[model samples]
Target: MDNTVEQVNVLCIKWGDKYGSDYVNTLYSMVSRNLSRPFRFICLTDEAGGIRDEVEVKDIPKIGFKDFDEKHPWAKAHGWLKLTCFANPLYDLQGPTLFLDLDIVIVGSLDKFFEPEGDFLVIKEWDKSDATGNTSVFRFEAGAHEDALDYLKQDANKATADVRNEQEYITQFVDRQNKLKYWPEQWCRSFKRHCLRPFPFSFFQQPRIPEGAKVIIFHGKPHPDDALRGRSGKWYRKVLPTGWIAEYWR
Candidate 1:
């Protein structure tokens, strides 16, 4: 490790009572094990009671649109709290920042994420043709994309009027300006789409990490722990024994 190297910020958010401290703690461990570059790990959350000591903790930043007249359910419905990372002058820390969802599993090197040159980089939506971002793992220079949140403050109704969630709104807005870029196709793989076998085959084959995939995203059902036990929430999509998750998801 270079003592004089600049420290990169790795950010995650946890709010409400859905995810316990274990989720955040595990994420930090995985990140530490995978990243070799100097980094400052931070978690912006409402309840930081159970997080480990090594990780820096901060309260979730307040957004500008708190009691808007329009029915903007980004907070209540979708995981909109993530947008706070784009807030200009975010918490005093500055430089390249990489944001990861608490539910993802890090199985490969993360140093390349911060190495790539781009205005804004995110996981391309697995199932979209119109340049939608998944936001599971995204990176941007601090204070570079304040416009994402500024639009919501200007007119929450008009900003999110047609979009269903925050990712769609943010991706569409930035993509239009040519600031949005996507990670290499194989870098970020979805557990449901890439790991789990097809419907019938899924019943017998265990979920495995795709070659060259650095991170596995558990977006909806069957979390990292769920995969360890070979439990696929649905009957159609089966998960057999997979030893890799047990070895990696510590």
Candidate 2:
């Protein structure tokens, strides 16, 4: 390890009303509790009213597409707004940055995330066989990925016409240049895949953290709050009240 102290950054983005202030507040708390290194907690948000002062709030970076409309089907289809993180110069603060989605629950030490060697790091899709990556938890140098933004701006409509989503676009863009990489197989995990008990066992048992998991992602429905209340977002999936969530979710 280097003798010099470095400023690690933990970043989160909140765009629309889909997530409220509580989500950002709790995520900040969870990160503050789990990370051992000295770090700056940042929230890129449109509304920063309810976030804690400890978290540095900045306006969400724009990708220079003034016509970008979130309500448009193509833009909404993928998390297109998240592409703003690729803005070159990215608001003064620049260094190794770990971008986390607001819905994740951190369960283990995060110091290791900054220790990895890579120009970019993300969770490999839990379902795909290809090199596609999930953007839920990704790491990259502050200004390194600006080319992805530039590529999107060249022809906004045409760029997304054949693509699945932003992650696909980013992975393909970086993969072409051989800069794409994934987190260690076990560090980042899915709640339903690794934590939830299956079938009849699910009825009898409560969700438990997987061994060695550092982060748990709640991708679709059954958010952390939903899990705490035992309200499975889907009618088919049963989510019993997970009291353990309260312990870590803050």
**Best candidate, TM-score-wise?**
2
Clashing pairs in 2: none
What TM-score quantifies how close candidate 2 is to the native fold? 0.94
Lowest summed lDDT across 10 adjacent residues in model 1 is found at 67-76
lDDT digits (tens) for residues 196-245 of candidate 2: 89998888789989888999999988899999888889988888899888
Q: Give the number of the best model, judged by lDDT.
A: 1
List where candidate 1 sits over 4 angstroms from the true fold: 1-4, 67-74
**Each prediction's Cα RMSD?**
2.5, 1.8
Estimate every model's Cα lDDT from 0 to 1.
0.85, 0.84
